[model samples]
Target: MEHKDNRYTISGTDIEEVKRKNGQSGMSYNEAIEWMAKTTGGRGTAIYSDTNMEEVKKQNQSVQDYNKNKA
Candidate 1:
């Protein structure tokens, strides 16, 4: 599924919760992407593909392989 660029807010309570969990708050788009990739075991670029579906799938598989081998 394609990921949408949804907006998220870092409220004071949210920030405090993040701090309690030793997490960082107030991330930009790029930062969120990196965080997602790190947290979910996938690449950030997979969410922003501009190529055709088949090519995107191929690239995504290649990236997954690369990431898996790098681990």
Candidate 2:
């Protein structure tokens, strides 16, 4: 789901949305994703590689754990 932006030469899913949320309306690609992960609910499970996916799942679990404790 790569959304290509001709103006900035960047690509990602929901590039405009990510940029809008981050107040970086020009940012794109991995920067957008990492920022979104930090700001949003949890780092989503699905990623590029199997090993990385597992790591993301673990990180997501930790995030959920922290939030659960806070609540």
Candidate 3:
């Protein structure tokens, strides 16, 4: 699993993977969170209980945006 500021990708199923999967899928942050939860069977830290998802999402967004341009 690859860890990001805002989330973790399990088995190559992170935001970028999803974004690429559906072609401009426009998946919401919450949807992504839920998707991760379902996919990992609660193994993903990004969607684990006691997590402040909104905060993680905000923090991660900045990093993701930066990476987008940097990459």
lDDT winner? 3
**Could you give candidate 2's per-residue lDDT for residues 48-67 as a string of tens digits?**
22346578899999999999
Worst ten-residue run, lDDT, model 1? Answer: 3-12
**Clashing pairs for predicted structure model 3, backbone only:** none
Give the per-residue lDDT digits (tens) of candidate 1, residues 1-71: 43343332333244445555655446767777767765665654666434377887999999999999999
Cα RMSD (angstroms) for every candidate in the order listed: 16.5, 14.9, 22.6
Q: How far is 15's C-alpha from truth in model 3 (Å)?
A: 54
TM-score, predicted candidate 2 vs. hidden true structure: 0.30
Q: Which scores better on TM-score, 1 or 3? A: 3
Candidate 1: segments with Cα more than 4 A from true spot: 1-51
Local distance difference test scores for all models: 0.63, 0.62, 0.69
- The estimated TM-scores of all candidates read 0.29, 0.30, 0.30
Candidate 1 vs candidate 2, TM-score winner: 2
In candidate 2, stretches whose alpha carbon ends up further than 4 angstroms from where it belongs are 1-51
Off by over 4 Å in 3: 1-48
